[model samples]
Target: VNRSATEIAEAIDYVGGILSVGAATDLSFVNVLVMRDSFDFAADLLAEIARTPVFEPAEIERQRQQVLSGIQVSLDDPAYLAGVVFGRLVYGLHPYGMPHNGTPASVRSVTRDDLRAFHEVHYVPNNTLLAIVGDIEAEPAFAAAERVFGDWTPRELPVSPNAELPAPTRRVVVVDKPGSAQTAIRVGHLGLARDSSDYLPFDVALKILGGEGGNRIGSVLRTERSLTYAASAEVVSRRFGGDFMAMADTRSDATAEALRLMVDEVARMQRERVSRRELENAQAYLAGSFPLTIEAPNAIAAQVLESLLYGLDLADLPTYPNRINAVTVDEIQRVTRAYLQPRQLSVVLVGEASAFVDDLVGVGFDDVEILSIDEIGPFLTRDDQVVSVDSFSPLLPLVP
Candidate 1:
């Protein structure tokens, strides 16, 4: 078990298996897939890596560099910048407000001892959930898991820290990228958590707003006005909290109009009831696609694990279609009106600020903050301090 990272990779490849580790907002997991004949070997390997990770100094340094390089590349991306700034605007000082990957400064300070302490507290039997799906009998699979993991001692899990997220507010921020032809825009406000009773109806509502079933935002922005090639909205539901966001990219000249229309569509969804036809389209798409999600063994495992992770009823899996179909127009309107705050939406725009700054006030966005692309890092680290107008000598008034 005292093997290098390269040794582990070669062993997995020798057995025709795949091993990967990933972290999310609420959980981290190690997933392994192998042919039936190699189940014992793969399971043992999985246990070794999950329970006894060495956090080798050289491997840690290599991975840290890789993450830093990735962050550097993302810094040059306008869409990434918009999303990061928007998250800060929505979540405030909560962990969700920060970038998932540690910032450049945070990354550089991580020590091997820090990694070991994190692993000691978090990697526990009580905190783990395993899902094994393949051509294997349930009884034997359970037995194999017990044999491999039964000896790992359970420990008391550390209490999770709690932080209050911010309430919705009408704040506008523009990241000035000189000479950029198109503006990347983000809009919306806080939404309900994953386990909220209103999640299904709200999900249906968002789909109609800009998802696969019926995209009112896309129809208006792309098809009708020809403002942009694409636009969409979605509700991201996490364990403790979530957000509802609508996004688009438009030419610099049309930035103000595109943003106005996106906000209007969101308000419209709340004000009026959707037609029977629109409701049916969204329901049918959701109900019809349910089966495809669990068509294969791996797919079925994923769906089952997600249900368990969110504390949903496993018995409800077969009834998913019925529940989706049961959602009515009245329910959609009820949830949207209860949740969507059009007037208080947080907005982010990244592009040539000079081309669109003067127009924002005309479109009803009077109070704004203008930050040069270079200022984003310091802006994110500090609390609500306005960057001085004189900082950017070439730009117009920083705020109107």
Candidate 2:
């Protein structure tokens, strides 16, 4: 039970020497909160995590091992596999699609220096935002902010690379696991970010597409087609433009058919006008769900945080629900036609590849590329090699 300092130091040195690199994981607590005098609250905590802090490699290693174990345990999990594949194909070269769980190769490659460098780039005072809401006034809030972040001096952000959005295009990617029992299917295209004004309308429109019980997507996928247990379309709204994905897990034999029908539904909305009933149902579902979603204090905090981070006005809160309520039937259909395109979408699936790959090629995708988990590892890494980790290595061995 009593180990010598040599034993512990040897363990750290051996492990550190073996891996040769260290990791740093900083999960941004993106607080979206609603409160009185929110801006004042933001000023108060501008440097919450940005200020000088000590690096913790021991913690990082602990976390790294924990995550590694989790991924290994989840290797048998079909749902995780499907989600990872969906992000890969939908985002393509973008940061959003980066492998969330670090690949074994990438983890091995990350040095403690890499994490230190990443912190310099991302964690800074000006880079952070705070939004507080409820039972608070603006004046006192500003005073509090001055007390909290008043001396918050500006600092240069680290020179991280950029992730430019690619023009939407069409393709079909398959994760062909032989002898798999079920098929996990996802179909859709890219959409707006948190800051895009178009985001609000697009979000409401997408909700109508699939979010609530009465909307078009929910009605069609679950009730009409009954293709699988459940199917729904939801936009992946993020700091960067996220994805608009429609997904369902169907029997392997019926996966291709389900995919085709979903595409038709997406196209149908684009081509045709929404009927009066569909409009009313969408409105009712959104408005009814709006207040209901914010009953919790945590959500209130999150909302405040979101508004602050995205540079939104406090007034947007009350007006947001109103905007959803005011969306006309034409607006819903127009947005559907404009944003959701079956032809412009990517078809991603995880299951028996034999069942659907040939049929998918028959549909229109001439460049159907079969990808394995290994082939995509680099694209999914979290930090430094976000663009292409392999590029950092020498070309001699690979080419030879």
Candidate 3:
């Protein structure tokens, strides 16, 4: 049991199969992909590991060290600092604000007893859902599943505490890294929940606003203006509620200029209806690319898992193309004005404090406050007092 993870991994590799273990906010799972002939062995191996993790003291220590190291590594990344701090600012004390791996102090405090208790409580069959996708037949798959997991006892599980969301305001939080050559910016605000009626329309709207290839932000900030090599916008959809985020990495000198362009593009989406050509292209791109996402067995399985997890109708998958295509210009414009609130945008920047602090103030940014990377913890612990400023030009001309 001391080398349980290693043993299981070796067994999986011996059979030329791949195994993945991961935890999400809601659940933890182990996924195995094996050749047809190795299916039975893989199934049994996964079952044994799932039902019988030993929680050895040595293994716990090893894993704890790994987690601590990972947290430190993430802290060193400006992009990670921006994202974690932004989530805290947006969600307040909600579970969404907590980092998935937890804080260093929290992780260090974890004991083997705590692990066992958590596993015993949450690892019941009634609370678990297994998804299988492969060339295997149903009869064999069912038999294999029954052989491995039929006896997992069901139990009543504890309910998670309901999180009360505090409304976030439009404020600028800067994480000052002494010698950072570039600035990483995260601009966003609270967005709709997963099951909102406007989900499809909003999806299309986001695609037009910042979907990979020729999106508005990419066109305006990167290709046309050349302020940065990469710029994109995304809606982080979650079960309760989510946020709309735009990210870009630009030279410290170009920080204010990039922020203005990004904000201007978002304002444009809400102020004016997107052109007919843009709408049609977004629809066509989504419809045409839908099939590619689920082209593989594992891909299909992933989609099925998402549908089940999010309480979506399985029919939604088959009807996805029609739903996207049905989004009219009116719907996009309507949701843009309703949901995309530019006035409530919270901006986060990770850059050199000396290089861009005055420049940020010069650009008329309101409520500018400085934070160290270490301060980007629970609820983004404020490290400094707010710097009062009246107004500065929101413009810095850039040339290609």
Candidate 4:
């Protein structure tokens, strides 16, 4: 949710300031991200957030305006609109389906009081865990923990019950953006949780599919076919099972073909596990790339922090790449059979539906009646209407 460098920097400052000892004191957490081990909260911080957030009205209002403007940007972009349709199709009723940034109605209604209440309920020490890293020592880190986060007495909380996910069914939702120049295509099913036994192999499959352009699926869809600028697949790992997705934006004329090609790619990968050389290249790429990335302060900090959050020891961290390298082709096929076989794959095409609707039906999408922006209202909304991911998660710049 921390979307920009300015926001992230400010957040880090906030964290350091809250915990630092010298004039060089680190700011509090709104600056430094407290990466969680799990979404579960720490009892102390949770209590403070729920009941005692010192929200400056001016700051709250600024954030609200920042959010409001973001909405307008999302509504105007077709690709952004397609993303919303896709997120909804997979996540259904989970908070994952909800916009990460508050909706307009929720945004407008949000008061300092609302945030305070939300923080206490969701941010308590019992509900949170922190992962710390860097040049800091363990003793001072613990002391900093007590100084900045302790003294949070226990309090009663609503037991966070397990969330229920909708039964899987495939259906296509096309959001008609009439006269648009391009079609945004997304295909895939539910994502696996980070802890799932199937996770590592699935990660390998995702890499082979869309992790890069020269890989098998990308080789067929983008390089050979020339239909899409780039087609990519990803398996997102969130608190629960994340949404696995493959997406591309192409000329509206090619929409139907693009969708079918993607569907065929899924069938291709599932039937044929990656070859030994592709697997070796992927492993070598991972092995060669990780150390260089590890050289940076932020990357090192992140690794340490994640370990703290997940409670992994030196042993768990180092063995990770080894596991990725050792994945058998059988593992890939097994995970595919288990998670990728949704009875119905939610197929969504966002443009000129009339031109491609019949083609899509021919390809096997149920064609869940196309929704006008007006119709998608009660189902999901921002104030009275819907906006897209453009508002929440921007297309962050590719690194230089």
Candidate 5:
């Protein structure tokens, strides 16, 4: 029997349970969590949803309209626009660059058969893993999984291998939102993979650089210079490469100054080792807060699921604090010098393009291009539109 989206949604809502669909570069997953007494009901609903979504033409068209509307709304948000362009710029043609919900054009072209073919290939017993954590005992949890899925035969999953990413090149992209009050800045380069040996040290270094209270960027830009209220830096990596992103939404007038200070802070990290006190604080922040983060069964299950997905040894989780504590100042310095490439950073700005284009060129950046929100695609094929840095002419001069 075909069920509407509202029917399926109402059934899950009746149990006061949660069901979410998530996608990543390597895989997509469904999650269901409910109270202990409602576990069996939740399991059955999840099984039904997973094994047999109606995928009716009307439902597909309804969802496609919703997704298209969402994409349109996201274009109005500066932070969202910046992130969308940043991902495309960082990942290029890789699958990681592909929008999880697909593009406006792509979504419109998806047929019911396309959805079925994708579901058939990806949603198989062999391709899935189940993790149940709550007040339930191990035996019952195991039995519940078997009862729900035991009859299913494992089949080979046909996943295409990801292509090799090209080397990153430094470029400055400006998405023009005229007369905007603030500029959303994203500056960083390609980062390491999740399984890199230097991940620990890089984490420590990132903490000192911009992890928390009064971090390097925040202290200098916000506290000292009063340029902005907040600033932060983080290295995010996936199965392939990631990007080290430093973001701040500063006043349009202070965009260039804030950018200069942020870049300077990164350069200083490579030149000078963090003091012992800074190192100790970063280690304490990571190690001391570790236990509190996993104080619940759901949190533990999530962590375990992440480990399994990434092929990380679950045994290493308990030793995380020890590894973090063992990081020395030298290791932070070495990792910073090796991985954090300040000169190779791609600067992305979403703001009044006329306000900062000349400023960026004045500050000596190359390959500065102005893009409209509609033009920020994975393949930005408008090389003829890129204004040469040496010959930049801003339409509007900076106010004040």
Candidate 6:
């Protein structure tokens, strides 16, 4: 607990172990990998880092600079900006809409006391799940975990604040990145949560729409029309909620056509029942991939941990392939019909807006809001300020 960051890093390196910490929308985790010979040291190290993070002011400032640098780099990336705007459109005021890395303003406001308070409230024995994988047997692994974490006290976690996710609405936002050659497009709306009973079948449906097994979105966009070099759609599931998104990068001139085709393909999945061949292909891919997910110790740990974290039955792990195989065409169609909101989609197109703004009307997207790259911050954070084409000075040509 008294060791410095450099000293901690050196210690872990001495044992040939890898240590990392990350936070996500739903959870935070500390992971360590080392040989069986270093198990005792690694376990203790893990507990020390998790339970006694120093959060020193100097270290926090260093990390803050690194994060701010990253945000600066992302600002110049059109694809990254498009994804951020898309999240805001889909999640609205929910925490999911906010960037995982705090904005420049938010990042600068964080202090040592804030970090300590957060860690004290969240880092508790009862709130944790320790996963040990590899050559260790159950009893010994449990003993090692208990030895390191046994003294840590538990506390009542505060109730998580709930905010209603905005319902899907058909709105088009164009992030006007002047002088850009390519347009990055994102389409779709809110999807089912991870724990929903409909998740499996709906996942199968999304795979057919734009995932590994069968990608009708890619087929129509990439293969048939050659509108873009690549295109795909996916459902991102989180603990409380999730979203469906179809993404593509196309020439600025082709933005409208690409966006139209993507939205049309999404609607088609809902209107039509997929062929039996497509259904089988998606199911086969999911079933085949199950084994690969748990082929190694780390992979096995991930699968087991995901099941536990999501409140899924651990016993169901063995039958994953069977369950995937059991999903039928009827099930796929049913989920698609129930969950797909094709008509109410949130769309974000980031690129040279003038290149394709006029053409968007031809594709039935008449109501559009265009914002310059510099204006994106306020648009995302503030309320009741509409930056429509008429009001945004840069796009004055389109307004007339």
lDDT of each: 0.84, 0.62, 0.77, 0.61, 0.75, 0.83
Clash count for each candidate, listed in order shown: 0, 27, 0, 40, 0, 0
| Decoy 1 TM-score against native | 0.94
Candidate 2, residues 57-145, lDDT tens digits: the string is 67567767887788776555656766766676677666566556756666666767886776665555566554444465667655665
What is the C-alpha lDDT profile of model 3 across 121-172, one tens digit per residue? 7676776666778887889888888898899898777765666665758888
Tens digits of lDDT, candidate 6, 289-354? 888888766667767777777788999899988888898889988998898888899999999999
lDDT of 4 by residue, 210-314 (tens): 774226657777788898777888887754557678888888777777888888877777777667777677667665676776674445555554444433464
Best by lDDT: 1
**TM-score (C-alpha, index-matched) for candidate 2:** 0.77
Q: What is the alpha-carbon lDDT of model 3 when measured against the actual structure?
A: 0.77
Can you rank all candidates by TM-score, best first? Answer: 6, 1, 3, 5, 4, 2
The TM-score that candidate 6 achieves is 0.94
Task: Identify the superior model by lDDT, candidate 1 or candidate 3.
Answer: 1
TM-scores, all candidates, are 0.94, 0.77, 0.90, 0.79, 0.89, 0.94
Give candidate 4's TM-score: 0.79
Question: Candidate 3: minimum summed lDDT over ten consecutive residues — where?
Answer: 391-400
Q: Give lDDT tens digits, candidate 5, residues 215-318.
A: 79888988999988889988787666677888889999888888888888888887898899999988988999899868876567667766776567889888
